[model samples]
Target: MNLKNKIVIITGAGSGIGAATAKLFGTHGAVVVASDINLNNAQKIAGDITEAGGIASAIKTDVTQYQEVEALIANTIEKHDRLDVIVNNAGIGGKEQLKTAEHTHDDWHNVIAVNQTGVFYCMKVALQHMMRQGHGNIVNVASLAGLKASGHNLSYSASKFAVVGMTKSAALEYARKNIRINAVCPGFTHSALLDQLLAVSPDMGEKLKRFIPMGRFGEADEIAEAICWLASENSKFITGQTITLDGGTSL
Candidate 1:
């Protein structure tokens, strides 16, 4: 889709799906703000976009902290003078979660802080601006685990479920404000982190694939495409929806 001159802020844009989405948006003529806790990586992405004749900038932000996220939006507006899109893509799956009785409390807190609270912060701040401007697009990156219970990753599942719920509730509240809100729930996808895991245990990657109806992991760019469509004018009528791109894993 043509995103000519649209101003987009993407959190966790240093790597994985966030990076892919930022690059894709830049390719389509959007001015991209690539924010991540890892400043160096974010800078690398921004540099890549600049080299390719796209407008972009890197900003260090820890979405888990409200002040940092607020500053991110402030800086974006100060530089761009407007916010067209905010992608709440900063999230964490945490270390493997045990059963209710065995799970560490810190793991639950950490996961919820980043995945749930962080999304809330981004949405709250962006809405204040979007409401005044009379239009915007907000896309929160949820997960297949959000739609279903993950016995082994309870904290991650809980955090993402909250994201889906937030997306729906917020979307309803702002449906008529010309601001569209939605969530993208993806299944097991290939990424740098997944690469590290597969490198350590190659067989586990193949084994996990059997459970997906598509018999393979979805690509990061595929998920980015869904996000782009939802943010584009083509899907202006699509709000308050959870678009699942999980290779039918939820089915």
Candidate 2:
């Protein structure tokens, strides 16, 4: 991937896919701004990259807050003088598996706030800068649930569906402006998010793996590779598409 010297921001970068992507971006010679709600984790990732001879920094951002999202973009631009790519990878799953009728309002709101609304905030703020700069790329981290039906998590499904929708819509709106927007829909990836799911239903991992044609969970670095490609010039002509990395489970 030709991400050399690109100034990139990744949300939810404290761990999992976000952390993997940040490190990958660093390796590709991009200036990585690892943003997360957890400042310590973000700092650690940044520190590791710096130690490895890559340029990186950590920014504490709660994506659910618009002001904080704005500050993230503003600070990056103020320091880097240009915003190249932003990976809206921050998201949360439902607390428990429940059917629509049995889903609690609080869980629904919280999930939506982080997954959908938070993505919107990042895009809205980043777009302003990109539009002014007349060039940029966006890679949103949606899920396979966003592409297909999720059995029991209505909020997560709905919010990710919104992300897919927003990615395509914005891609079209900004296509002529030299801005590209795309998404990666990962299925059953081995990340903290999946661990949380498995923690809730300890026996579900094997059952879920059985459905995948590959018969294994995806590694976070695998998804990061795709994200880096999408953000790089190699995929410059691609936009408004959701690349699925699900071990063929969605097939």
Off by over 4 Å in 1: 192-202
Off by over 4 Å in 2: none
lDDT of 1 by residue, 1-251 (tens): 86889999999999999999999999999999999999999999999999999999999999989999999999999999999999999877656536778888888999899999999999999999999988999999998888987776788889899999999999999998999999999888888645744664659898778889989999999989999888888888899899898888887
lDDT of 2 by residue, 57-129 (tens): 9999999999999999999999999999999999999887899999999989999999999999999999999
Candidate 2 lDDT: 0.96
| Pairs with backbone N, CA or C atoms under 3 Å apart (clashes), candidate 1 | none
Candidate 2 differs from the real structure by a C-alpha RMSD in angstroms, to one decimal, of: 0.7
What RMSD, rounded to one decimal, does every model reach?
1.4, 0.7
Residue 114 of model 2 has an lDDT of 98
